[model samples]
Target: MATNQNFIGGFQVNRHLLIAGAALTGAGALIGLTGTVIVGAALASAGRGWVRQLDTPPSELATRKLHQARAASLAGLEAWRTGTDGSPN
Candidate 1:
């Protein structure tokens, strides 16, 4: 008489499914890590800008220097415009 040797209702577990699930989970974790790194870099850049803006003394000094430079340039331009030839006063 012939006899069956297979057990567990003759149902075999698919190895492909297990491998595919692991690969998908690893890919998702890598994507999540990459997204976190990108967000951290962006936040650092924005935080630097915020800190620079918050430093009132340095910002004021820079603004004063810029205004002085602009005024000097305007004065030089006026002097050149009123001169006989384009020679600087």
Candidate 2:
């Protein structure tokens, strides 16, 4: 009977497989870290832009958005009062 030196009991341990697994694990970790960094940078940039917007008074566009939102809410209330929400007559 012939037995490999890397065999323990009845199981054989392959060095190449272990090395490949370790390399893949390292690559996955690096990729995850890079993605996290990119997302964090994008969030930071967006936050800064939001802060810059807040430093200025509301623009005409902002006022128009607010008015539009109020108008939509009023329209919704009117619809509710009129029972136009798809109810069986």
Candidate 3:
């Protein structure tokens, strides 16, 4: 009778330990996922700021170069339409 009681007690203790371990594992996984999501969001925000800076055109040199390239392309296209190589006016 005493041995039977001891066996039952041991079984219950083992069950409780298993449940606690599973809960801890689930909590750790949740924490890792949360950290990953936060890091990804921070990187995405920084990338957006970098892209915005590139698009803002804050320098005269950059604007001038862009205009020059556009003009050259337009001149080339016009020459092609008129069936001649572009030459200086």
Candidate 4:
């Protein structure tokens, strides 16, 4: 008589399937861990940059420039709405 069976530690199981499942599980875990590390590093770097920006005070010239730019944009919008900018309707 001939038989085909696999026994491991007194347990009859398919060894090939078990090994393949383990390899797949490990690969998934590795990819998940790598993604987590990359995201964590990116967040950490951004936090550092944010902290640095918070520690610095805005320059007077830069603030003035921002205000001027905002005023100019608002004026342009107003002129366009009233058709005072002289562009063809």
lDDT of each: 0.81, 0.83, 0.80, 0.81
- Determine the C-alpha RMSD for candidate 2 after optimal superposition of all C-alphas: 7.4
For candidate 2, write residues 1-89 as lDDT tens digits.
Answer: 23333455767656677778999999999999999999999999998888777855467668989999999999999999988996777
Off by over 4 Å in 4: 1-11, 56-89
Off by over 4 Å in 2: 1-8, 55-89
Candidate number of the best TM-score:
2
Question: How would you encode candidate 4's per-residue C-alpha lDDT over 2-84 as one tens digit per residue?
Answer: 23255666556566777889999999999999999999999999987876677454566579889999999999999889879
TM-score of each: 0.48, 0.51, 0.48, 0.50
Residue pairs in collision within model 4 = none
Clashing pairs in 1: none
lDDT of 3 by residue, 1-89 (tens): 32232354455245566678999999999999999999999999998888677845457668998899999999989989998864666
Candidate 1: tens digits of C-alpha lDDT, residues 36-87? 9999999999988987778576778899999999998998889788774555
Sort every candidate by TM-score, greatest first.
2, 4, 1, 3
Clash count, one per candidate: 0, 0, 0, 0
